[model samples]
Target: MSTDFTQEQESFATAVAAFCAREAGTREQRDALAEHGQHTHNQGLYDKMAELGWLGATIPEEYGGADGSVVDMCILLEQAAKGMAPIGGIGPTLITGAAYEKFGTASQKGAVLGGIVAGKSYSISMSEPEAGSDVGNLSCKAEKTEGGWLINGQKTWCSNAHFADRILLVARTGRSVAGGVTRQERGEGKHEGLTMFDVPADIDGLNIVGIGTMGGKEVNDLYFSDCLLPEDSVVGVEGQGWAQLMTGLNIERLILAAMMLGTAQRAFDDTLEFITQRKQFGRPVGTFQALRHRVADLATEIECGRLLVYHVARLVDENPTKLFPREASMAKLKLTETAKKVALEGMQMMGGYGYATEFDMEKHVRTTLVSSIYGGTNEIQRDIIGKTYGL
Candidate 1:
């Protein structure tokens, strides 16, 4: 895979960097915008990105978006995260937008995609209390109703749901069919009867409660008790949610990998600044052999992560409709694991300061530590990659 950026891509990166510096250059600014985890973003800043066409980076031009490539979107996310910008909702919004553009009906696309370009964010609800990695087993049922579907179940870890305009929901609609046979007939029927829906957040019978987490108020638990969605809300064909989910997951993993790459870079840059200034034994701490070697290793590792992430981004751009499952999984696994390692090492190197909330190291640690678990656990990624190799 080629790892080089063209002049246009390079210019775009530069512009994003400048935007980050001006908007979210300080920890205090980020804290104020996030409001002690009560919110996932600064709406004002988010609107600015939309107005500047950054939020619509992945959207098609017909929907008032830039029609930019996946690689461009990756660059924008990397810069935003590296600068600690308060645009955490943008990733999910873009991912949700992609799914809508692909499978949504004309009206669904008009509402969701139009909102996305107009600076509205969305949340995705795939993981239920019982279905995280094994999403095919999701029990969130949506029964047929008079005018629509009556959904009744619980969805957990729904990020940005509290403030999002809409949700991309996956629920079980019927029985599973495995290899042209049912599970009761002695076949693997783990991935059937699933359907996708575009649920408005303010719909009656839908309740969202904030879930306190180490990563702040970034996620919530949702209860859908007779949540009524019109028949037109279904994104694609019923009983095809598994295939639809595969498409979204590819982009989701790539977006996460890009964010982690930026996060790793941020942690390394912060640690390097700390060691270069703090003196010990009458010299800068970075001058010590052990500390210097570790820094060098981390820098090299981050560079490798960058190449892997961008290579996957390029593949995605080249084949937008094709699912590069193996490559996307590899990128997600490598970057997330590397991010965790880099953050932990940076914390250890920073010693006391790293453990304090006053410093950004602790925040980076909190964020990167969960990267492995969210976009499907690193173990799952490894399993997927191995299977592609005929393991």
Candidate 2:
């Protein structure tokens, strides 16, 4: 991972890690920052990151961002996760922020991108009850009407929507459009007729209900009932949402991969620290051949994951417009799976202590277990990779 980073990136990583350690180094601090287990995002800590200008690591300088590359973002994300920062909002925020950055009108960019740098979070809603991996099957509809559009549909698994300033809502508009300034963007298929909307989080007729899960209130079900949106709510070319969304996948996958890579490293680090201290059979348990072999194997897997994550990230920075269906999917698949393995193995090694909330290993286990489940599940990632090879 360090091989792909420049000196400035390294310094940036150090600063972010140091800041995270200072702000959220202990469980007590984390509990306070996360609002006593109500949610994982710590707004105070997030605001501090914004003040330090880290949240805009990949945004353009004209918009109050550093204009950093994808690799730079990976560095920021990995260090934050490795330091165990509790800001859950940044992942989704950055994803949606990129959409606006690439396609939003001047006003939209000024509102959303500028808000992002000012510590405001954002979200995107692409999944419905029946359309998780099959995003093209989404039934969420935004129909044209007088003076604007009326959206009426339900979107589930809309992460961070409960606290977002705005949401990038993708809904089905129609198929085989006749004419518009961007009409040619309407490709024929299930992927066609989709449109992107900038839905304000507090807009009337939109309801955000939290869904309790193993990860707490990180996601919500969004109900849009005749949600009236201005004609300008449309983002990018009308009916080109799937193509627009696909443009960001390389960075999206890289971002998730880097974060999970950090989690894997942290899990391994925590396990090693525990085993080195907790003596069994008159010596540190980590000294035993059985545990030592397992640690070695997990360590190797994490390193491999880290390398792949950064390698793919560099590819994105080099080819900003190209689709990396195979490589990006591979990175997401490798790091998420490896991160899960590391946490589970760490749990097994620490025995009862790993299962106890008093230890961070249990938290690692919870987070890593779901890394493979979100951001395009590992199963879907495998399918994408296989399809890339014409399978």
Candidate 3:
């Protein structure tokens, strides 16, 4: 079930694995970092990766990146997740980079990608209290002014916004043209009139409040009262944020898929390790037929997920302009669902140890549990995939 890779890619993955083993070697170390509010890797680890040119893995060489392919990024992310490396910041940064690369102005690209190569993180803010999966329904308004745009709205579930160097803020720019009525002014079928803005995290009137969650402080609610941005803050054309978002969603989903694949493998590996060592009935519990079969099934499923994810990554890399929505959605749906299944099964198999904080299985369970909910819920993914078939 493993994705086929060239010798160079394999070598790179091996190096990443070795790095993880050294930096995030044990569950205790990872837990300690997480306890200190580094839900993903700390800034030091990020800086190290940046120095190694891993942070700009997907950006082109002109922008200080290695000009690597998406497949390369998938390899890096999968290994990071498997080793429990605190590199969760990479995904959001990648998406933000993708957006800037495709639709941003020259200055925007220079600033954002330059920051990435310098180990700065970025996060996109699209989901509002009313938006979420229905991102087009977002009501965050950015009205045109003499100098630039005046932003005022609330965005929830904005992961990394609290610490991100810049927030890729998507807001309503024009009024919906339907029936000559402005949707933002009226509040229905509001898919148009959206624009993307690059706002610095420390901008005036921007307040990021961290939200408590079972997983930790991974997301936040951003309130913008009088946030103003210069004319150059817009990523692309005004009233085209939806198209811009669509352009990056494929990459975003693939990034999540890779993370989930690694997570599922880690859970399975942890469970295997636990069962082989913990004895029962005067023998190893892994010897039980039922448990053995379960492990085999999970292994097979994980391999399948890996193949699908890499396949999609390759397809997107081959045709960046084409929206392989079906393939992208399939990858997200499968890996997320499989990750959840593997974590839950690993927890059940390990019993008390799985539930204990000393073990990583419960943490895996918590993280994977939300995989199906984020990056456009699995339900939304399924609907997108189904629509591809003209269903």
Candidate 4:
């Protein structure tokens, strides 16, 4: 399939790239921002993006969003990744915004979605200490109380929690294992008992402890100690969080795939430039057949990665009801793996220069490595894909 972007998409990407190049391209600036324990220090840049109507690209215009398409968001994300902008946590924020638009009460939508479009941050709290991949086993419990629900549990690996204004928390309200409970008995005719709560970040009992990561962003361990919320906090019908989360997962995987592809393309471009400039044996290194072949292979893989991601995005936009677990998994797995491979090959081709902090390749390596581990590991993606084949 042809992978070229449309004129509008290309224009959007060019705008994002130009913004990044002007505002966040220097090593010193990035390191300084990283040292402050901030994800991205350019709220000015973010605000500019928001002003350009890019922040809430996929949400409806009624909610102060751009009413853009998911493919548009992918284009922006790919551009950010290529620029190595510190906007890694943007996917979760956008996903939470979409979820609010989909399942939130009117008040919830007015508050959360409006704030997100205004460039306020948010996070999704799904992973716990024991519930990394097995989300159903989450120990975070939300029990009904006089007014609403009281949440008491801890969530780990929650990115952007430290700076988020709210968290889209998935808490278990009843006991039900996968395939073992009747949908009607629990509440309705689907996965039930699990509920999504819009918990404020500064709630009385909520605690956020920053955790260091290799990519210079800080994830957090969030403890919800009897954190209480009003009745309006629950998203959609009670006991339908699993299905809701499943719907969001498809978009989440596609976003990550786009980011991975962007990084891969960046790595390839950096390697190409380096090989063409650095001379070895009185000739540019890129003139060698071996390095040329390696670049060709990486370019081909990157093309495949882009196609897989865009195809999945198109499918999600075209048919939201049809389950695409395998397709999503395949896209996530291949893009992440390709990102790592491209980064490694880029570094190897650049030799000593690649290891220098002044060079972008080192940062690319670190960032791409972290990408593989987050948004579900490639190994887990394989397991999901295998199970789809009735394994």
Backbone clashes per model, in order?
0, 0, 1, 0
Per-candidate RMSD vs. true structure? 2.3, 3.3, 1.6, 3.4
Candidate 2: stretches off by over 4 Å: 176-188
- Tens-digit per-residue lDDT, 319-348, candidate 3: 979888999999999999999999999999
Lowest lDDT block of 10, candidate 3:
32-41
Evaluate model 2: give its lDDT. 0.89
- Which TM-score value belongs to model 3? 0.97
Worst 10 residues of 4 by lDDT: 182-191
| lDDT per model vs. reference | 0.87, 0.89, 0.88, 0.82
Look at candidate 3 and tell me the lDDT of residue 122. Answer: 94
lDDT of 4 by residue, 114-227 (tens): 887787878888888987877776768899999989999899998888778899999888865458865534655323578999988898999999887765555889988888
Against the true structure, whose TM-score is highest? 3
Model 2 worst lDDT window (10 residues): 179-188
**TM-scores of the models, in the order given:** 0.96, 0.95, 0.97, 0.92
Better of 2 and 3 by TM-score: 3
> Model 2, residue 359: displacement in angstroms?
0.9
Better of 1 and 4 by lDDT: 1
